[model samples]
Target: RGGPTACEFSFVLETLGSKIAAHEGEYADSDCYEILSELALLGRYELRALKLELRLAIEGVRADKFELPYRIASERTGCGFLILPVTREFHDRAFNALQSLSLASKHELELERQVGIGMWKNSEFVDVEWIFLEGGNPPDPDLEGRLAFSYPFRRVSEQRLPPIFT
Candidate 1:
């Protein structure tokens, strides 16, 4: 259940303090206008819901500090929700789940053709720029892990298993 657009405008606002704090002198530039326009477009209901949830989670974390265990969230009530926070022993299991999810979201393409796959944190199909991809990352390994598929899906015959003599 999502609108065509979503924003965490209030998150920015909360961190920024008053609205005027965002619009003071040189700060009130085109970027600020864009932010304000974005904020204006938000559904107040959605903002309230997200803010409430974030505040509770933030409060809980603040109470426990950063050492607060990682969580698997369950149903939420007006007061709070059930969360299965990760323990040190099960941290590896949680890590595996997160790593797998990250790997699932990313992709890599070259020359309008895919050269690799990307695993990102978000479940979204985003258009990425070539320059951005080129800037970082070590070479993709030639083994199974995060799957990589180059463009046009080459025929099986294109790759040789090994030389016949070998």
Candidate 2:
């Protein structure tokens, strides 16, 4: 199959937004509860903008024009789970963005630690992991591995001074 389409990406984001919305009231007493609620609201607007950006980015471009840093699993975890492998950078950027949205440092740190450990899991590949969240259909797996091992790496050769021994 081919890489994940923009529609699939949008669907995944929407599913995540829905799950976040559903849990908005679960931890009302937590310090980061407000931030979680705010994120759910902001996610809707951001997801739309992201879809537009993705559409523009892929417009008139060939399938192989750009490579994704991680893969999408072809099968769902059960029925409503979509497993998405994403780079650590992507994960960090998302949380960092949330932090920049007027969240207190303590709250931000707590939220990151909680969500990172609770929601996300580490995969076998380096700098990549699967996001197994509820909702959305399974997308076709990308034909690559994690970013660190996606491409071949060349080792540098050491130069020797042969004349000095003679």
Candidate 3:
């Protein structure tokens, strides 16, 4: 009996397929390349629960100074990662939609912020990278305020889909 694992696998595959199909145009860009790669991996493995690594390039947060949670235990499930303070208006909506879908996956998916060691940037901006860290480092403490938070994706499905460029 495949049990819940089978159901979870089907759900994950459907979610990934719909999202990728809806946003086929995004794969052409290098920035979203990694995101696309990871999505492809999840679909291949049919993973139900996964940890998302956020390589958050805070405009100033030092690698040493940056902090993460001691553990990862979210009330929701599924793998969905979202970044914050998006400079582009278009990407802002895209990230928001992704967060919503991920939250609704009914799997244990969480987002963690990461920083580069001794890396520096010009302005008060952040670059986010969403990765699957199943056997890698665990998630850090959740960030407060508008800067970061696990996305809430309750009504994610084929009908209520995120905006994907073709």
Candidate 4:
């Protein structure tokens, strides 16, 4: 009779499987790397919840410097030490997509303004950060008639875009 602990493991594995299947490209269909990633994350938290061991926190936030409540939370459920920092690798495809969006600034060479999205992977003692930049600036993080042109970075599954991170 493995109560809630076992049930939690079952649920986590199920979610891990689904999330794996959700990843697009050769990585999902052939490599299956996403599932392995999920397991690594879940295993971190599971150790904390079940074994009452040390743990860490994974956070994604928009560095707009004003709005606060819109941060993104990435979590794991076991082991707790290995903090995997996963994010959308904005190589070339990301920039081309941002270029198609409407711009709202004087710098004709730029998209919107600059909006920066970031992820922080923190464990009991370690922290790794990743940043994704779009647009360039929005005049300000506290204004109405404006959009940080480069925002809405095509929506990567585990991404939290700036000016509207989640």
TM-score of predicted model 1? 0.28
Q: Which candidate gets the maximum lDDT versus the true structure?
A: 3
Residue 113 shift from truth in candidate 1, angstroms:
25
lDDT of residue 74 for candidate 4? 31
Judged by TM-score relative to the true structure, which candidate is superior, 2 or 3?
A: 3
Q: How much is the lDDT of residue 16 in candidate 2?
A: 48
Candidate 1 worst ten-residue window by lDDT: 125-134
TM-score of each: 0.28, 0.23, 0.25, 0.22
Q: Candidate 1 or 2, higher lDDT?
A: 2
Clashing pairs in 2: none
Q: Model 1, range 17-96, lDDT digits (tens) per residue?
A: 44446567646534334433433443444344434444443343334332221211111111111111223343445444
Kindly list the per-residue Cα lDDT of model 3 for residues 13-51, writing each as its tens digit: 354455556578666333244445544544311222232
> Which portions of model 4 show Cα errors greater than 4 Å?
22-166
Question: What are the runs in model 3 whose C-alpha is more than 4 Å off?
Answer: 25-33, 39-166
Runs in model 2 deviating more than 4 A are 1-6, 24-49, 52-86, 89-94, 101-166
Cα lDDT tens digits for candidate 4, 49-162: 322211111222112121111212233221112112222343223333322222222122233222111222222322222122233444444322234543332232343223
Candidate 3 C-alpha error for residue 121, in Å: 39
Position 157, candidate 2: lDDT: 28
The top-ranked prediction according to TM-score is: 1
Give the Å shift of residue 106 in candidate 4.
Answer: 36
| RMSD to the hidden true structure, all candidates | 18.6, 19.6, 16.0, 16.5
State the local distance difference test value for candidate 1: 0.29
